[model samples]
Target: MIHDIAMIPMIQTQADETQKRKWLQKALNYEIIGTYLQTELGHGTFIRGLETTAIYDPSTQEFIINSPTFSSMKWWPGCMGRSANCCILMAQLYSQGKKYGLHAFIVQLRRFDNHELLPGVTTGDIGPKLGVNSNDNGFCRFDNMRIPRENLLSKYSKIDPDGTYHPPISDKMVYAGMVLSRVNTVVWAAGHLSSGCTIAIRYSCVRRQTELLPGGEEPQIIDYQSQQLKLFPQLAAAYAFIFAAQNIHRRYDQIQSEVMVGDISSLQELHGLSAGMKAFSSLATNLGLEVLRLSCGGHGYSQASGFPRIYGGATALVTVEGEYSVLMLQTARYLVKCVAQAASGNILPHSIAYLTTEPESNCSAKSENDILDLEILVNAYRHRAHRLVNEAAEQLKACLLSGKPQHVSWNENHMVLIKAADAHCHYYTVMNFVQYLQSTEMSKPLRDVLTRLCQLYALYGIDNNAGDLLQDGYMSGEQISMVTNQVAALLVAIRPNAVALVDAFDIPDEMLGSILGRYDGNVYENLYKWAKESPLNQTEVHHSYDTYLKPLLHQSHMEAKL
Candidate 1:
């Protein structure tokens, strides 16, 4: 999967017959492991600002690599600590006294025979993290590291033996890998959310609560409207995300195919869409996992439940690939550009064409069936998102026209603009879900369940943005209540299928690695056995504890008598 989703377009250039026979084949055969190391302690998001330098020395016919400061040290590259023997390192390239932006260098960090660090290389493990601990993320410093002229991954940019430089066909091509990585992260988020929802939903079904009637047995927590409200919407979101994942993946694959054929027209759109979707999807999945965790009550807090680890792992994604807020701004910048282009009477791409249209104030819905229609709710969200984006753009334009600088205007209205971008992305996801369900390829039974989930997701989203829905007359106050009620009812209808639904995801026990979430329904027994394995339980007491407690008790008794 990682190889198939290589982010750096340069990697593709290097993957030709000769290079593949030499490097790629070895890596595929497990004779070598390589880390794509781009992030540094000082620079992560802003690749343009990286400090590591790679100078082309024509006399020696080598590239001299140096990490100029502690902050310039390579950080956060998976498998860099111990597993990787080579790495694709990003460094600022210098040749003939001129500086080129960040470029990739294939550097040998360890010997193939002994696996010892090479001279001029300082490296160590970054230690344990919140999750992804199995990946040996590492830190390294390069001091005057030298490699042959061919070491520079020159498919994109290169220096000849004479120290003359050649530019990449396109500057953005260098960053294509990172953008693809971001898109892959979006699909990964869907899988993580599905895993969490599956566990929570299955547990909810088996765990029963208070009896609903005098002679009735205690009902499954899934039967309660409140419980349904909490878990079912998340289940719905899980399905929605799965569908969105497929859409984004298809879009990414199409973009890759087009780029390979030298079509650069859609690069900017794909970059922005990938960034926005990754940010949106990861945040939603993170939040959804938390909801699933809380729905499980105190058990969710236990490590045995697996929610803690899953939640931690999922939440870190918001920061790792890119910080959520920062990535949202990337999307916002693209959105502003699209809005400007649309204002100039140009046709926008399909991904953002909604931004060009005027929003309607009223949407018609009368009966429960009408309100429950997923298309109707999705359309309502689309209109609301359009309205928000238009308003945000106007606010930004007004500030700019009043003589405020672009950065200043952006800073002043950053929150509103980001929120608008987020709304737009959410609407896209919901529409993707609706369209996916409408496809003939989908099974009828699966479609019915997914349709309910779509409605639940839309209603939950709308309730959160009730003010916009009301102000735009997308829904009346009473209609809002009716939708909310129907959403609640749908959750109840979905309860019986919760266990079966999650079961279909098929996460293995080894991968899940939780006692409470075990498949056999022996949570308490496993919990007890796990507790007994703790080191503290090996011995009943230490001599110090016994002596101190007995003395303290005797002293207390004598003092009381006195």
Candidate 2:
């Protein structure tokens, strides 16, 4: 889906016909590994602001690459520190007294013959991280490294012998990779959230707690309303994100196809959508994983529960392709632009038509039963989101007209405007989930489970943002309580299938790389085994014990005798 979208664009741009024949094909075949290297220690989420320079000398016809400062080193490219022989390096281009913006160049980092670092290339693994430590994240600096002109991935831009610059398309075209990467992140968020939900749900089912029913054995924790409230909504979010990711992917594919045919009209929409979706999905998944962890109580804290590591791995996405706040701003900027156009009586684009339109009468629930249906609930969210965005836009306009400085106005209203964009994106995600569930191709059981999950996700948001719902009169005091009750009831219903649900995710124990979240449930044994392997455990006692403890004891005895 959208989350895996980056693999295609990066692979296509970086690898040539010959390189593709030799390495890219093999990498695709899973024989070799590769990763895109764009973000540097000094700069992330800002492509135009990179410091690494690739100065092209026309006389020699080579690009001299340099990382002037320590911070300019490539820092977070997955599998770049090891495993990859090559990388698509982004560097500022300079030649003929003119400077080009950041561009991608395929650089050979290591000798394929012995897998040793190539000349003028300083590179090493970054070692462990918060999670996903198995992947070798690395840092590298170029020491006046020289590469041939052919190294430039010039599918969209190129330079010639005379030092003349030529761009096949707009500068935005070069940034397409970043957009695609963000879209892919959205899809990956769904997977990560699903993994966490599965583990938490299953553990909740098997793990027992205080009996709610008298004369019964201690009840499964899943039966607890609080436990269900915590997990069921997350399960719903997973399903919602899955559908959102798929929809985003479909939109991206359409845009990619159009781009290939020399159409650039949809670039802005794709950029906004992808960026917003990435921000929304990553943040939600990260938060959702934590919720899952907390739901498991003491077990979740144990590395054996697997939630902690999963959470860490998932949380990194907020900063990976793009920072969450920065990407949200990108979406916000686009939304504001649309609002401006609509206020001028210009038609809004299909991607953002929701902003210009008011909620349909059918959008709100008329009866108590309507609250339980996933579609109606999602529609309600969409309506609320639309209203919020429009309200934020109006607020911004009023501030501008009141003679406030543009930056000052934005800063003052930043929180609400950003939240408006967030809610709008979330509504889109929920709606996409509803549509995906209605598809004929889905299996009945999967559809049924996902439908419940979607409902839970929508209700969870409503419950969390109940103030918004209550203020808008979308839900009354009594109806809001009913929402809570409904959510609790669904959690119990989902309890029996928790184990089977998580099992369906097909994550290997090796990939999970956690002692707590092992498939076999031998958490304690694994934890003990892992602890024994630590360097500190290699010896029974330290030399310090003899030196310090013995001396202290002798002094104490002498003082007592005296």
Candidate 3:
């Protein structure tokens, strides 16, 4: 919790030098266990709507924290149940009968010596989830909990002993934690999806299926066109996300340095980029992992295959940090603003300069062979994204022109907005992939392999969303068919190197935890050996057979005889 969530907000956003020293010293020394508490039973993404309150008591120089309603009870915070003794909590601040917006405060939750719950604090584990159960995610509540006035994280917003208040430099700056979390999630998703693809691809190469020549040897499944279609795109996505993740993380560090100097001009753009990448990466990784799992056929269902565990952990990533749809909408809002600015001749950020330039009107790909060019594929993506963003913006304008309220217009057209965001993110990822291919210095053989992967990635993206490309007039129906053919060709070209590609990831067999994905490819023998390790097989399962099954069988036989 200290390194993952609380450390940044606590030290960078609010804590003064003295406060930082004290907290850092304790945190470093393990004198205090810490967690970040923001999401409540009722509020997940809406931080301003949190019902927990922190009211100032100038007379005693303290802040009284309270969970006024059950919904205000903090839920889903890791380590709050039994590990963390302190939390950086978000609560509504009130002073001198005037309400202040949400603020952060340091609240001690458990006693240090005996690990007992502090008075007025209530917490416990939330119970089993889809996965990650070992982390001990917990729920929490507070009733009239009092802490010294200094406990309020005051680097950004502060209250004096005499009850005067100082506001933050920017209201948006307060959400630094969310931005950091989202950026980190993009990197995490890339690595996770890479691992999952590694396991599934290696297993596929070893797991043979289908004797096309009757009574002949069954071919390895990795040789099938359908299997290549399923797994190769995922392989491409892992590489694409890795490239994008590196750039996003680099930009995040730059933003942090800029923020330290009190320059927040780039904060909004950074937030939008991180939100979109997080949404895109999480959604893609979740879908891609599941596809990889199913590509292995029936064996993928077994826990011993390692797919279930990878999929379970990836599923939660979609909902946490930010809900997928909500974050997509956030990116859509930014795109809408960008479109409006561009129409008025305003300059756009370097990442979005394509919006200012006219979209490619002439068809770049005249035939199936022409469609294989990287520049042609990128142009199609840019044009489609341009049209989608403009269309969404126009929908909003029409709604506002018809006298609908702003919020109502946005809600009614949310579907259009989110689709625009999806297209924009796809365009960004494709461009990043293209740029990396052209600029990166690498061996000729590695470059050749990556070039095919990038082509597959781009063409597959087009094939999957052909309707968007067609509807925007960026590609003809015939052109899309060509894209599909190219995808197939690229898949076949990538088949021989599939095992080698996965091998390059170099994941340890112990870390993979899959009998099917063992390095030596002795799948059938390992499956048997691994099955014997199950607890159910420890004593030949005789206890259950004698205790219930035999008795039931005897009773049934007697009734049959009668």
TM-score of 1: 0.92
The parts of candidate 2 lying over 4 Å away from their true place are 1-8, 13-23, 26-35, 39-50, 72-79, 82-84, 114-119, 211-216, 343-351, 360-363, 402-406, 442-446, 472-475, 508-562
Candidate 3 segments exceeding 4 Å error? 1-14, 44-50, 68-79
The best candidate in terms of TM-score = 3
**Poorest stretch of ten by lDDT in candidate 1:** 1-10
lDDT of 2 at 2: 14
TM-score of each: 0.92, 0.86, 0.94
Local distance difference test, each candidate: 0.78, 0.74, 0.82
Give a tens-digit lDDT track for model 2, residues 1-562: 0112233466564344654565456556644445566546556444443477899989998999986444322333354566677777778889887778788887788876788888888777776778767667777778889998877876677789777888657678877777877887887898888888767776666677777669779987777777877777777777677778888888988988888778988888899899899999899899888888888777688766777677877878888777888788778888888877777887766658776666754435545567888767866787778777877888988998999999888888888788887987978877777777776477888777766777777777877888876777766787788777777766767766666766777778776655555677665676788778877788888677789988999999999999
Count steric clashes of candidate 2: 6
Cα RMSD (Å) per model? 2.9, 4.0, 2.3
Worst 10 residues of 2 by lDDT: 1-10
Q: Residues 156-200, candidate 3, lDDT per residue (tens digit)?
A: 788999888888888776677768778877887887788888878
Better model by lDDT: candidate 1 vs candidate 2: 1
- Highest lDDT: give the candidate number: 3
| TM-score-superior candidate, 2 or 3 | 3
Alpha carbon lDDT of residue 354, candidate 1? Answer: 83
